[model samples]
Each structure stands twice: as structure tokens, then as C-alpha cells.
Target chain A: MTSSPEIAMPAADPKDPYAMPALMPSSADRAIRSFDYADFDIPTRKQEDFRYTPVERVEEFFQPFASSDDVTATVGMIDGSALPDTVTVRTASKEETGVPAVGEPADRIEAIEWAAAPSELVIDIRADTPTPVLVDVSGHGLDLAALHIVIVARPHVRADVVIEHTGSARLAEGVEVTAMQGSELSVTSVQEWNDDSKHVGGHRLRIGAEATLRHSVVTLGGDVVRLRMDQDFDGPHAKSDMLGIYFVGAGKHYEHRTMVVHNHPECMSRVIYKGALSGEHAHSTWVGNALIEPTAPGTDSYELNRNLVLTKGAIADSEPNLEIENGNIVGAGHASSVGRFDEEQLFYMESRGVPERQARKLVVHGFFKELVDQVGIPQIDDRIMATLDARLDESVAAPIAEKADDGTANNNENYAHNQEEN
Target chain B: MSTLEIKDLRASVETKEGRKQILNGVNLTIESNTTHAIMGPNGSGKSTLAYTLAGHPKYQVDGGEVLLDGQNLLEMTPDERARAGLFLAMQYPVEVPGVSMTNFLRTAVTAVQGKAPSIRTWTKELSEAMERLRMDPKFAQRSVNEGFSGGEKKRAEVLQLELLRPKFAILDETDSGLDVDALRIVSEGVNRAKENTGMGIMMVTHYTRILKYIKPDVVHVFAHGQVVETGGPELADVLEEEGYDKYLPEGTTESALA
Candidate 1:
């Protein structure tokens, strides 16, 4: 299968300085067409939403849509290296059938599996089980990649899943997840890719009735990252909480878009997205849309988007849309904001003997703690924190490396380490 | 050198017109293994004195020297002061969302100790501290001060003081908002720390209920940003019985306490 050419359209147009391209449809009734990378579309300054995140840069760095199995293999290879160390590896052959290493969630657990497009992995967690699972995938140079997962919790099961990105430095991936009825699933996805990767991944979750799902995503890497999460509530009385926190550095562009559909009556959904942008040319985009149908009465939904601009040259965009056709629902609302770190909090932390960088780290960590804490699994939580630490290191390290190139490299390492100490 | 010594600490707050004096000219010294009670009516600069010692920016110390033992407390940043064995239990502790009390305490303890304690030791210490304060262990996992009752907040401050083991602590109105039972529990936690360590303490309060549990060796009555009267525990009883009316300036009246 090939992506539609329209997918390649530049998010911004160079020739049209005044006009922006129209946004992709916001309604559920809109057509779903194949996306191709070859046909590039660009947005113009005229568009308020795309004013900050120019898709043109993505077009310049990436090639026009081309069917390259190399890219797919690249992504597949990424999955191989970063697979959860403790996953229940069930190979199709009998030799691979020993208990698929589903380590205890509260303990050390990592899961990663690769299968044919039609294959599925089942993770059955028992009731009241607070296990943590870590999953990893990387498609550094792959073109098209797709992975499917089916998590089955016998009634009243609860567990946490942590997914990490390592080698898949630049590739597109499609992921699918389905949770059975009465299962509580908490999933945390941490993306810490190299600056060279152009990453695109989609996560679709189909939740069963009376099941609870908590999803937290942390994005801190990749040059061009476009991630979309779609959640559908099929069972009545089911609840879902989705949180996303992202930090973008200079010359980096990241986008996180989400669509949640409340299909059943008396269902609930909450989405919180926070981002920080720094550096001279960092860019971030967030588009959130929630659809509440007429039949799904008594549904409660809330969406909030908050952004912090760490530097003047940085850019941030936020778009939140709530479309409710009928008035029978209990409550539905959405809020969005873009701001910088509270100077008061920063000054307070700084005055406390926390050097500037350490204070910044603390504030940023506190910002994301909202989502990170939802992942009930300690193993996943620890890994996510480690990823954040690495990204912060990378952010501070890259500049030092550049300075070192201009001077002495040894001194550069010391300077970088010293800066981190600050 | 005492745990804390303040020399001519003059501080003020900025207003729309100009700077308004908060602490006119105050001087105090507290030795280790002793507790000093600084009691006064509202707005008498009791809290200001605590915040100034902790290096709060709002209260500019126009003239003063705050020394923690021999080191210049004013020269050290708030955190440096903390690491050097200074602690302040605020009258209103700030709510830090998403950061658990356990995580916060662990980091603070490690920072103060210059190394991380073993998880076994740390967790045991945490449980014991919580038990001493009569706090639910679940509170350790909750966001700092988020959704906590008034009494819970006060207890948390004492819990932190126990875990951090600072050489000197300023409990700013720790008894202001607590019920009788809460006050007793908090006082017991503080008393235990006092018994275990040679740390000195400056307790700022308007009420005398807590004094019954944690006896103070000295009492200073603060008025007009200065220690108007320094006496023994008897001063607390007299202030509660007679009120500060007789001490007020000529033009001031009862409502001036506001």
C-alpha cells in the first residue's frame, strides 16, 4: 500500500506569501484517502493555525513520496533492537512459545514484537494487576511500517505499558491497539530520536465497555515528528484519559494531533496536552478535535492545550475543536493556551540554590509529571524519566559540541557537563 | 556561633506609591538545642522575619545580616541555605502540582545529604516520619500540598523537617491553622526532632496552644517589625490574657490589629 500524494503537500507555500492552504477536514464524515508523500502542499502565513509550524521545511528535508522497502526494513530493524527486554516473545514456531516474557508490571518489564501485517499480539493481564510493560520500535531509514497489538485483560485487569523509540531515527510507522472489556490499560510512549530522523506514527485505540485507559506520550526528539492518536469508546461507562507532553529544540519541528470519538452513552474522555519550545528555530503544532454524536448522549469530554515558549525565536500553534451535534450530553468543553514558564516559579526555584539549568529541569519535569504519573507502572515511569534526562542532556550537549568544533573538544565536554550541573 | 543570628534586619515591601517598611529594625539570636518563640499579632512582621531569613525576594532586607551559625545566610541562595542546615515551614505552603511529596522529599533529602540514601533506608525513614506525624502513607505519593486539608499541610511541613534534619528551622505560624488534635500531633513531631538533634528552632505564632506541647526556652514579642519585649514563656500568657492593646501606639486602636 502506498501513501497518498496529498500527504506530501508542503505545509506552507513559498510562492503564496499571503494565503495558507486549507486545513484537513475536521468532521468524522470527511473522506479518508490514501496519503502520498510525493505531492507536497504548503501553507501560507494567511492561515492562523499554520502561522507558526511551516510544513514547507518538512517538504524540503524529505523526498517526494516514494515506495521504498528500505525504509520499512529500516523501521523493522529499529523494532528489533529496542524491543522490550521482558516481552512475552511468542514466535509463530513452537520454539518461540515459552511464556511471552510478560514480566510483572510493577517490576522490570519490556515488550516488543514484530509480525506480519495481519498478525496480532495478545497481552492478558489479570485483575487488579499493576504491571508495567516497556515497548520499543525504531525505523531509522524505513519508508512504511505498521505494527498491530491486542491487549486482553481478563475482567478487571490493570497494567501499564511503556513504549520507547531508539534506532528508528527517521521513518514512518503505524500502530494499532485494542483493549478488551473491563481492562484498565495505562500506556506511556517516550520518543527520544536523533535529530536526523523524520518520524511519522499513528496510534489507534479501540476501547471496550467499562474499560479504563490512561495514555501518556512524551516527545522530545526527531526533526519532523507527526504523531496522531485516535481513540474510540465502544462500551458504555468506559473512561479514557490522554496526556501528551513535548519539548522542541532549535531546528526541530514536532506535531501531535488527536481525535477522540465518544460513541457510547455515559462515556467520558479527558485530554491534556502541554508543550515547551526553545531555540532559534524550533516549531511545534498541536491539533485536537473531539466528536460527540447525537446518539451518544450524556457523554462528558474536556480538552486542554498549554504551550510554553522558552525563546523568542521558537514557535507554537494550538488548535482545539469540539463538535457536538446534540444537546443531550451531560457536559462537553475544551480549553487551549500558549505561554512561557511562570517567571515567578522560575525565580523561586532559582533562588533555592538550584542553578538555572537544574531549576529549568525541575520546572519542566514538574510540567510533564501530570501525565507521567498516570502510568501506574514504576518501570515505565523510570524509563520515561530516563528518556527525559537523556533529551535534556542532548539539548545541552548539542550546543557544546558546536562550540567545541570552534575550539577545543575536551574543554567542550567539561563545559557541557558544567552547564548541566548549573 | 549560634544556629541563627539576625543583626539589625530592616526590611520593607514595595507598594504602589513606594516601599513600605515591614521590619523596621529587628535583631535576634538563636542558639542550637534551643527553641525561641516569636509571638505577635497579625502583620507584626513575624512572617516577614521568617521569609527574609529564607531569602524571599518580596521582602527586601534594606539593612541586615542573617547568619546561619558563622556563614552569611544572606549570601547563600535559598537552597544553599537549606543545604547548609536551614529550613522554613511556611505559613501557607505552596501547592506544587504533579510532584509527589515523597519525590520532593527524596530529592531534597539527597541534595541536603549530598548523596542519595538507599531505597530501603529512605523508605523506612519516610514511613517512620509519616507515622510520627500521624499522616497517611498515601500522602507521600500525592502532589505536594495539592488537595490537602489545612491540618494536613501543617503536618507535611513537620514531616519534611523530620526527614530533612536541618540544623536550624523556622516554623512560621505552624500552629496558625491547625485544630487542637492537629496541633498536638505536629508539636509532637517537632518535639521529637528537637530531642533527637541539636538543631535550634524559631517558632513564629500568634496562638499559645502549641506551646503547651513544645515548651520554648525564650519568648520574644514582635511589634512594629522589632522585638518590643523579650521575656520568658510568661509573656505569651500575658499577651493572650491582656492582648497587645496596651502596647499599641497612641493613635492606634483595637481594629489596628487588622
Candidate 2:
């Protein structure tokens, strides 16, 4: 590892067992940011940002290390067509891109990833494309890796981009998106890793004047996945809609944090996230923060988070915070909820001859239909529903499997009978 | 050919106070192609009989049995009972968001029939049923019962009854909130089901106004969780004129009417 003298160092050695604390930030945005590995302290359970995360499971990403070349990335059209002429894709060094970085890292994992990534995979969209651009990243083995991606939408350009993560790896990633003036861009990051994978990612977005951005995060599979998204309106008349969906299974942990900052006047932002948890040890956390500065007058912002707990022993924590320094804003509000399956809905379905398991599936599918429709991509919507169905089946079968072990032959008989009739 | 018998059925519900008994030794029987209207005051357990037969989880069955064509109805789940040719037209249909009315109807039909219906025939049949009920075609695409007016909810219920074609139907206060035109439309749908399927009907209501449209062969006056009197169709007119005053105990207060 190369060490630079210009990097700021902490006052005490973070490795020392008995070192005096240097600094502790009161707010989430006040966390330290640096390029040097030693400047940021190793995250622990005590830190607010890391409290809900399984810090021990992702310790490898917090330390400085060399990233393996096993990770590969490819770009193509969603329809299997060749890349459009209006779009260009190439790998360049961070300095070669010449695009100003949107924001700094907020924590140790992000800082380590920023300093370790060898090059950035940059994709530039000059005009509207016929189909969505697909960036597929796959990890071949269980190895430490780092990825940096920069997406630039030129002035007045319109495009849809999807970043898909699959396979198993302990990786840290940084994705930066810039929507230039008068441009419209939609970016969706889908994390569907293998059962043993661990991932930490940071997404930074900057929206220019008169621009619109629709950002989405869909996390389905992973052992421990944590992502932090920060978006800022750099000019007036910018609008953003941030959406997310996540499903946590047995022994899985998923956390998503979003921070939307309105720094310019007449900017509008909306953030909505929904998640479902099933099976024992399944955990999910969602924290949404919207901040409107005093200078950002006439801003309209709202953030909402909803969670459905499908079974016993699963945990879901939802928190929504809104801060507005300017009372002149059009509206600023926040709402959150964590609840279980509605018994009345289940009963209603059952009364119509739908069995309990199938009834639960229909209700869950309905719960996500609204947000899934907002995704506005048929392929992604179908894929997301298919995965959610499979996971829900597993969740439904788990309790029945236990019931079978307990020798509840009647339930099994009923289930088999229903299956035969179907 | 088919019959539904409720023998000394008793039920109770859990409230803030305690387990309150709602049904006490309620007995009734109806044969195919016959309509029986059960008239009762509020809180007299008329709706309880319908829900208990449908196997709603909130009502606990303390004793007795319900048989549909000689099969024990209480032993089955709600879905199983539905598949066994028993239908309940709820007074207040539930609102299920994001589940389109067409999709819900198709699923229910599939579950009850043990197989899926042909898409071509199903679509035509649904459109025809809605047209007969004076319902807009766009309702098929809307969520089930969501944002529907009272009249619309009742019409949707009757639409299901006609489509499912069950052998026995328990209409729990189906005419409570309908206007004159909506009442006639809904009654026409029920009469069509009877003519097409020969289904037996147990229509529960508080007022006899609906008896004019869906004529009943027998009328049962219910009070204090028990059926006190049974007579012919003319009994409805007697109760409609004099009210349920004679059915109550001597010197019973008006507050007990509900």
C-alpha cells in the first residue's frame, strides 16, 4: 500500500488497545472523510451508523488492502442489442475522467474503497437511448474486491441505467452519478449476491438545474449488505425521486440509508422505501433523512419508509427524519411504519377460497405492486416479483417444515389435500 | 337436491368486557330452490349465524354443527367451505388494495372450481355479469371493493354469487344500504343465480322492505339470539306493520331492540 503525506492522520493510533478518543460526530453527515486508511477509525458497534450493521461480518472491507482482479464488468443493452452510438463506455483513471467528484466518503469502508480502486468504469450518455443500459458486475470467487463507477448524463440527455451485482464476493463499491442541466436520468442498483456474499457500497448523485433524477435500490440476496446513498441538488428547479425495496431472508442482514439535501431554491425531493422480512434472524433497517437548507426556499420534500414483518423472530427498524431550516418551503414531511401481515386481508382472501399460503403470497405481491410499478421497467419488475415470490415461498414453507417436525400430521394432510385439488 | 342445516349452533365473540355469547341454540334448515328470510333486530346474532357458517376466525363455536349436503361445514376452513358449495355474501365486503377485481374473481373461481376457466369464456362472462348488474366495465380493472360506494359493494357481492354458482348462499343483510334502483338490480342478480343454479338462500335482514323483491317462502323472527317465531311470507308484512315489539319479553325496554 502506498502512503501519501498529504493525507490527514488521526491524533491517536486506531490500532492501539488503549488510545484516547479523538473525535465523535454528533450527526450522520459529520462523520470523518479522508483518503488515507489511518485517518478514519475502524467502525465499531458503538458508532451510530454502524450500530445496526453487522460490523464484525464486514470487517475485511474497513481495512486497507489490495483488490483482486476476479471481479468483471460488462455493458450492453437490455434488449441484447449493441451499445447505442450516443453512449460511450471505457475504463479510465479517476484523474482522466475530469469529472468533479460529487461528494466525499462518509465512513471507513467508503474511504478504503475510494483509495483502493485502480480505475473507474465511466459511461457517458450524450442523448436519449431506445433501451435501458445494463451494467452487469459478477464476482467469480470469494475474494476482496473494489469497484468504482462514474455515470455522466450530458445536458438535455435522457437515459435509463441499471447496475446489477451478482455472485459471491467481499467487496466495496462507489457509484457516482451526475445529471447535467435539463437532463433526465433514472438509475437503479440491484444487489442479488450469493448467500455468503458481503457488500458495502456508497452512491453519490448530483442533480443540476432543471434536471430530474429517479433513483432506485433493490436488494434481494446477501449475507450482510449495507448501502448509503447521498444526493444533492446543485442548482435550482431540480427534482428527485428516491425509491428502494428490500427482502431479508433467514440469517440475512440488509440496511439502507438515504440522505437527500436540497441546497437550491425550488427543488423537490421524494423518498420512499419498503421492505419485507421473513424467517428467524432476518433483519432489515431503513433510515431516511431529508435536509432543506435556509437558502433552499420553496422546496417540497417528503420521506416515507414502510416495512412488513411476515413471520416471527424477524426484525425491521424504520426511521424517517426531515429537517427544514426555511419555513418558506412548500412542504416538508416524513412518515414510517413497521407492521405485520394484516389478518383481515388474509381472512378476506381465505373466504374467497384462496388457501393461507397462497393468500399470503397475493397480499405480499399486492403490497409491493405500487412501488414495483414505479420502477417503470417491465423486465426489472418481472424479475423482482419472481424473486420475491420464490423467497416468500421459502418463508411460508419454513414454519410448515417445523410443524412437520413437531408431527402435526393434520396440517400436512390439509396442505397435501389442497395441493391435490389445485 | 341440496340442503343446508344448522343444528343448535352456538357462538361467542371476545370483546373488551369478556366472551359474549351471540348465538344460543340457533336451528334452521333450507332446501334447494327455496328462500328463507331471517328477520331480527340489531345485536340479535343474525350476522353471527352467517359468519359462523363461513368459519370466520373471530367467532368461536361453542357447540352444535352445520351441514352442507350432509358434509360437516364447521370442520373445514373458509376456503374449503367455499369450495364445498357454500357462499356468504358479506354485508361489508373487504377492500383489498392492488388486487384488481377481475384478477380476484378469476382466482376465486379457479380455487372453487378445482381448475382454471378458459380466458375467453371468463372475460365474456364477467363483462356480461357486470352489464346485467348495471356496473361499469372499468370496475374490473380497479382494486377489489376499494373506494367503492355501498351500492357498488353490494353489487360486487351479488356478482360473485352469480359467478361462483354455489349450492347454498347466506346473504347477511345484503339490502341494508342500497337505494331503490340498486336494490332491484341486486335482487335481480340473486334471482338470476337461483334460476340458473337452483341454490338455496338464507337471506338475513332487519327490515322487510327487501322481501318485496326477493320473495321468501318462510320467515323466521329472531330475538335474544334465538328464533322466536316462524311463519309464511305474510309474517314479514305483520312484522313490517307492528314491528318486533310482540317478540320481545314483557315490559322489555326499547334499548334492548338493538
TM-score of each: 0.72, 0.91
* Poorest 10 consecutive residues by lDDT, candidate 2 chain A: A413-422
Local error of candidate 2 at residue A232 (angstroms) = 0.7
* lDDT over C-alpha atoms for residue A38 of model 1: 25
- Top model number, TM-score: 2
Which candidate has the highest DockQ of all? 2
The CA lDDT of each predicted structure is 0.68, 0.86
Candidate 1 chain A, which ten residues in sequence have the lowest lDDT sum? Answer: A413-422
Residue B137 shift from truth in candidate 2, angstroms: 1.1
Count residue pairs with overlapping backbones in model 2.
Answer: 1
Model 1, global lDDT: 0.68
State model 2's lDDT: 0.86
Candidate 2 regions with alpha-carbon error over 4 angstroms: A1-33, A36-39, A400-422, B249-258
Error of 1 at B153 (Å): 1.4
